[model samples]
Target: MHSDRRVVLEVKDVSKLYRLGNIGTGTLSHDLNRWWHKVRGKADPYAKVGTINDRTEIGDSRYVWALQDINFKVYEGDVLGVVGRNGAGKSTLLKVLSRITSPTTGTLGYNGRLAALLEVGTGFHPELTGRENIYLNGAIMGMSRKAVSARLDEIVDFSGCAKYIDTPVKRYSSGMIVRLGFSVAAHLDTDILVVDEVLAVGDADFQSKCIGKMNDVSKSGKTVLFVSHNLAMIRQLCNRCIYLENGRLHSEGDTDLILGHYLTKNSDTARTFEHGPIRKVEVIPETESIRLKCHYKVDRIVHIPNLGFVVNNQFGSSVFGNNTLNSGMSANREFPAEGVIEVEIKSPKLVVGKYTVSIWFGDGQEDFFHEPDCVEFELIQKSTSQFAGSAKVGSVLTDCEFKISAL
Candidate 1:
């Protein structure tokens, strides 16, 4: 589909398999058989023996395929987002591209140098200082000492660990380690960058900074393969996305459409509790306020201490939250066997973006029903404000009159 653009990476029929149990007894035989087939230019014999990776069920075979018949292409300067549920073959695909592991079948063709930060402290030595490891990683990437020295200061400053540059990596916290690792990988002049969910180890501010750096990298005409559970980041940082499910390519297309599909597929609406006080939960978005409705039925008197919703933006940041206790509602009362309770959040001014709502019902310490990502909706600007082009961008909007005073 990207014929007009030059391809940077190509993956064809890629698959990875792992033995389920112990690896001692029949491993040698399988390895010898694989080598025999390779010498004869035949397909891998074990490729036909593995089952699809489904964590909820046990398969008949002893081997499982982490990836199967996976295929896609990454054009030069493309920021590709890889998304799926846990154990969905995302990391395995990246490892194959990074050459940390070879596919059991098929092949990968990539041009230019590639760098991967698949985990925190992936290529670091615990005994080495941060400064030393920077060069060490550069050396491992086939760069000379003089070449690494040219970008050493930029890496240290971007990592925000300049003061700890001389300290051994063992002393750094997990966040610091990730910061340094990402800084090195991003600044090493690699044509292709592979990043996993390891960015989650850093704090919120650091994560934002790293996203900004990735944006710069994409603008500089390099290729990026980013994998994360944070769909909002994927939407903002990537122009194209790949949705992998059950070790296969489910869909691949534009960022917004793919994310919509992913969110719809992973919604937790089917959750239920046995004989619980609550019966239903719903969120209705209105122009002025969001209407939350909770229907319930009870045989005996029941008291609920807390009940309300929490709103979060795309990056999973909590925008606002409220509960019955904090709103001065009673917890020592009973409700009708069949009745509806409604709460209105009035004048919730928010920016133009998608948001998710989580509803909870129970006491402060204990929960009767807590549903996350129950509803997702977008807020759009009805009219462009005179100040819309201003640099003060934020998720929340407020109505205030502007005044100017003479000096």
Candidate 2:
């Protein structure tokens, strides 16, 4: 599919090296050594000694390669998704592409103007008003004052910060900064948009708007590079995906194919026990409630066996949890040697998505059995409410009553 499209960006043999424990080569001697190598037209003396950027393992080397030997081509109008574990160089790659940092080893070729939102308040001056920062960003992107002025109202409205547009960005909350930053980047006259996980700081509504804006940008023949851990958003936005591991491009291809491989490789199956007391578990989602059924077998007698479970979203964050004792249920007698335990989570305001269930069985004194990600299910919205298809903010929905009164 990429064969027919024009290549808007190309990354060739790119790598970024950083010295451990200190910035810029760590010492005067090391800096001199690197300078000496550069004067002699030799490759970086430290670059060769840097280890791959793997945070899990302790390495003997003092230098680490944040990104190494990366190569990829982004076609015009392509929405490329970058996925990786936390320290897998996704951010480094985007920084290199965005020109926030230079690659240690290779070059980046850009066919058009590039704008990036790598962090909250990435290009904003804290003392500057949000309105002023918008113009500053436009100026940085090489846009004229008239052009920026033409889009100022649209940008401010999209950001939802009109009430505080004249206030200094220092006083703006993190979420507000993100809203303005994203709005400026999207509305600016840039040909390629690069966004990191900074969108995670925004509320769900802003995130949905950012996603929609990126889609519009792509449809307008601009390229986009998105880095996110949210697989759902990645699947929804990207047509092509690249998986990074240990500072390298592990694989790149169709989004679903790459996501499947990534999930299979990084699945939390290792956290589950092989021979636990809980023999089987099932998580079934219904219109109004979620049903959790656990079948267990135990040889020893357990007094007042308490059954508890936690529901985690796809990102492994605990959404909510409940147990027999906490829910005002009484199981004072001894538990059966073998039996099925059924639990109905009623009226849970869960966002529509996939979730995993982790179970714990124990008495009031101690925990007897525990398993993480024991079962998985999807929550579907059945009510025909006005906000049914809107992007949800967090893991669970809130039931709040609103009141407006005049003094």
Candidate 3:
């Protein structure tokens, strides 16, 4: 048994293995064959071949390891973020830890109760009403009816779905469904919580509420296991992070450092966008950072191209955008085949989030290059306000003029 003072959860040499082309078609026949062989007291011919625990030797030896010898310990009040690219086995790891699926090998030990929000609507019953499903989900998590009832109002209020408490969950919108399901999971008095990257579905407000709740939960001394593509949120909520890559633990340490390694390891970068013969783009140093500066030039032999920029937030919301033509400004000159254009600004005036810079080079006379999305950046905000207004990382800087008028 682990302890809050020590480690609350420990996974030792844990791994999950699945067979290839080994999916069930006639399981009953296979079972009968095994039973018959056992009754005869003779080893089944396919036994050794079919049931090997070696991940490398399984499934015609073409096996995939969703997790490979993972080891970690989470202490009470520790929030651990598990991040990776798509198909990086992040969800599979959570499934194993949540006991939704059993590991093929290794032992997992935990002292306190665990509640998992693997998918937003995982525990929700479409036929059941919100009020009923709350109790149902609580019971599923090993909570008593009385405990669920005690927290029912809080859950409903938190979900902001009180008016539809008696309505069937099937009638709820996808957003509402996810909200209520997460609320139920959040309210459970568990020693640890595991949430997958599905939080990307909800609106901004709902996401904010989820983050706030997770913060409060962490403060109350519960262990947290979070999986997300939102690097900013992960960095803010988790101090430590584990990076999974191709079914293996790539790195484990501070959130920023781990994510940095994860990104550096798995980044797939393309040069630029291709709209037509008139326009093209090439990223200078596309990695992860808030501030970005680029050079755009047009051919003097052809038409003069107009350049524009759009700065967006992580959620793809266009916070601000401007173009040289609309601003009644020009690039000061035209391009000579491959001339240099310098555009700089102190960027990313939003929370710590992934942002991409959209560049458009067009003739404006007709459509030189059309609006072609180019350049990507990841903005990591400082941990505190002390770092605010200190250093700018993007192009463009503004001097704010403040004046006080009193009557």
* Deviation from native of the Cα of residue 150 in model 3, angstroms: 1.7
Report residue 254 deviation for candidate 3 (angstroms). Answer: 0.9
Candidate No. with top lDDT: 2
lDDT (10s digit) by residue, model 1, range 205-279:
788788889989988989999999866678778999999998999999998788777866765322334567677
Tens digits of lDDT, candidate 2, 81-156: 9998999999989888988888898988889999999998899999999999999999999999999999999999
The count of backbone overlaps in candidate 2 is: 0
- Model 2 gets an lDDT of 0.85
**Higher TM-score: candidate 1 or 3?**
1
Worst 10 residues of 3 by lDDT: 283-292
Order of quality (lDDT): 2, 1, 3
Q: Which 10-residue window in model 1 sums to the lowest lDDT?
A: 382-391
Task: Give Cα-based local distance difference scores for all models.
Answer: 0.83, 0.85, 0.71
Model 1 segments more than 4 A misplaced: 23-28, 269-407
Model 3, span 1-407: residue lDDT tens: 23536788999988776655767523678668867887997754333443333333334543456677889888888899998877677898999999999886688998888888887578788999999999888887789999988999999999899999999998998788888878888887788988887677787778878988999998998888999887767877898999887677878888878977875654421244343443344333323223334444454444545667776655666766666667554545554565444444434244444556676666666555544345555555445442323324333334468899999
Residue pairs that clash (backbone atoms under 3 angstroms), model 2: none
Q: If scored against the real structure, what TM-score would every candidate get? A: 0.73, 0.74, 0.68
Candidate topping TM-score: 2
RMSD to the true structure for each prediction, in A, is: 7.0, 6.7, 7.5
- Tally clashes: model 3: 10
